[model samples]
Target: MSAPENREAFVRPPALELRGVTKRFGAGASAGRGARALDGVDLVLGEREFLVVLGPTGAGKTTLLRTIAGLETPDAGSVALHGRDARALAPADRDVALVFQNFSLYPSATVRENLAFPLAAPARRLSRAEIDERVAWAAKLLHVERLLDRPAKKLSGGEMQRVAIGRAIVRRPKLFLMDEPLTNLDAKLREELRVELRELARELETPVVWVTHDQAEALTMADRVALLVDGRIVQTGTPEDVYARPNSPLAARELGTPPMNLFDVERKDERWITADGVELARADAGAPERATIGVRPEHVLLDGGPSDAVVHVVEDWGPSRVLFAHVGAHALHVLAPRDCALRAGDRFRPTFDVRRVVVWPRA
Candidate 1:
């Protein structure tokens, strides 16, 4: 290699990079052609960062991860890893590990055997002692040391997922690509694994690109979130930033539990008013004539305040209660404390903290 080439190679690049990435499927102009999975995606992942890719079905979350892992080639654009072009690199050569939603383990093999496979590969040529050490460490880290000798086929969904994750971590890859690894487990197990995975990522200091459709998981686990919609990145920011202050009403609706409550406010007499004639805050100077206001369920207050709505249904979630209310013709979802004395068919007033409300120009 030339001196300049060597110098360029030595310069640390982003852990993962995609420039103008585009991927489509099936026929180009068929009547029922396959959809475009990714559209001109430009993303950079920094070292030791946890970036969660969030979106609905067909939003291209899995496609982005596959492109990074070299499982799918882009129709256009470039992929680079650690300052090197990765377009030609095979999946194994990319120094990236992928953990799938299905816990894709060797079913016939023992947990220990599954964990050792990556380290014992012919290309790696690791000594048995080294491979054993790696397997032991991974098993211990994942709290699966007791189950190391158990067959993968006999384990529960959560246990198999832990083993699958152990296999990926045993190799100590430069990047981790996780595609809904916790989706298969029950809610309690999913929460347990989620916390463990976050700690493990921090301990290893490895860059990770996690793909999921769960809003709570994305908000809790991501250092930063990249929300993909219609094969494009609609927004990328910290969880609080994205939830509290969204660039668009669509982004706000996508992140919340029951989604944000959106209402079109009209500018009448220089005052913002809802359709129900409820008075909202004053309009901003540069704000358009009409704007959509988004308020989250947590921010929506349903106490002894103004009365523009009635309690439709109260859902008890143990520690929290979700009130589905009717404000005029609009349905409002509000999150409240479990001890609140509200129930079905009860009348109540819904107001929100103006500071927490998000306003977007109506289109």
Candidate 2:
């Protein structure tokens, strides 16, 4: 197929779509207190799109994933896969593959057996030769072919994860759902597998909805990320869009390494009059009258310009230095290159990167 036709052929509508999905737990007396796992959540995943869902524990990340995987039913909503109503189909019939956080492989099973299990489904009805072929293919794809004869119980966490991923891929499903598949691996292995997983997803040309609480994983792997909070999708966008232009304070807090420094400050005309009497020029003069002042640590400089402040603490974190300064009652952090010399108890004027400062309407 030509590039355009290949793209058209791959356009299989949305691999998954959720419309007004809501899930609530409990009853009247308990209902007033029950958790609302998902609230009117709506999302769409294009064919071959890799989307990650991020949220803290108890944020309903699992619930949302389960709903899509047919493990949990929403109280109110519709789930469609390839324009077909998904609620009508069972998990196996939906042509979806899910890899759980825990390597849920049978202890006695060898890697080959584990990879063959999904293909052995009655719906698949593949010949023994076909199953063996797919299992070998998947193991090769995940670089686990050498370990195909090893029992699941004897495999290392990373090796077992690869086997689990291999099993998922061997099914050749329309969509792949992963719930923190790399959470158990060591940092180095996790990083290695993350790259491999991305390549695998691309090579398979299947839509992937991966659930992860790790911001770095979500940012690095996803074509788009859906930030879930208390079961609601607070925001969804490309990593850069979500990080650079957070729609709310909650959304802003979810993305950054140290997170953006938010301070309740008074907005006077086109300037920010911090509680400590420091004045910050606003790049956007038409910002809300009373708003929160947000500036990332990297945007605050210790020297070479205007405002003055008393340093409270300086923390050395190898590659960079974080300076905690008191501007008044509010404490602000300034991230500086490690070579910059500044100490605690020192009073110095700091410069703000006006272009990077963000103003949000007071919450």
Candidate 3:
């Protein structure tokens, strides 16, 4: 390669990179006796990227953030920050900001002081004017400028969260780490902040590694998502890609709302049959005799079909209906239009969108 090309290639690196990172708790981390919080996880985040680590509770989402922030040390593998090994950097030296679900702030101080606290760190050399300017900028960006003079104790939950996030942004760190920061807010506030935070991250052009168990946040805000399960990195892809083309049943279960309905079935000739000998759908000629298949709620069409289904319950969503039903022996969820006149004890023939069905080897 030419010298200029070499130089260009050398200059650009991922904002954050993790390779075979492993962390454990309890006894000595290296003894292999402790519970592993992170295990052989690999991920890469591009410059100014928004990556959400989506997982269930106890999936080591919090541990992943702490390891990135230098608050926790991994027992194995490497963490690279902007191409440099992070083994030697202290938490403060890594130039990263962390925001948590619980609003961590100085309750007695005004919002201005809370936002400015990070800049006042002993390690930072910012002058008073610089700190104040950044505080104003962060507060304005978070739409909490009006609450600057209010005591932290006086702010509502949403305001306090904005301030917590403002405190992180005021320092202008290279990366932002958020651990379910909106989980504590009411539904309306959480919805509002999700959009706001996404815009803020783009406006700042700062890379973020936000972790959450909420699939909604991952789907709505992420440029890409990393599925973490049992301390392992299961899958990484754009929200749409991961949602539509999950690599495994475990991966399929992580993203969907009302979750994907999975079934274990046996392939019989050209058909897939459920446990009780009821035909479910068509099976690929080359497919395994027994495997697991997944169908999302919306894919279960109820207009008219071959199989009989009895609606056990109906939930009226604002614009649609969710029917909990039994199709033969399979308990299923079907999404129907709000106008559909279906109630409990109603019966319909349910057909599935076979093209969208996902199949995996039975485990």
TM-score of each: 0.90, 0.92, 0.94
Query: What is the alpha-carbon lDDT of model 1 when measured against the actual structure?
Result: 0.86
* lDDT tens readout by residue for model 1, 158-252: 88999999988999999999999988789999999999999999999999999999888899999999888878888899988888888897787
Task: Give the per-residue lDDT digits (tens) of candidate 3, residues 4-81.
Answer: 999987789999999999999998756876999999999999999999999999999999999999999989989999
- TM-score of model number 1: 0.90
Better candidate number, 1 or 2, judged by TM-score:
2
TM-score of 2: 0.92
| Collision pairs in model 2 | 27-31
The lDDT of each candidate is 0.86, 0.84, 0.91
Q: Count the backbone clashes (under 3 Å) in each candidate.
A: 0, 1, 0
Please, what are the lDDT tens digits per residue for candidate 2 over residues 1-363?
A: 499988877765788999988888776423444568888999999988999998888888778888898988878899999989999788878888888885569899888888899989887779999998888888888888889898999998888888888888887889999999988779999899999899889998999999988999999999999999888899999998888778877888877876788777677776677766676555466777677767788988776544567888889889998888876566778888999778889887766678877778874
By lDDT rank, best first, the candidates go: 3, 1, 2
Best by lDDT: 3
Residue range with the least summed lDDT across 10 consecutive positions in model 3:
300-309
Off by over 4 Å in 1: 1-11, 29-33, 275-282, 303-307
Candidate 1: pairs in clash? none
Score residue 126 of candidate 1 by CA lDDT: 93
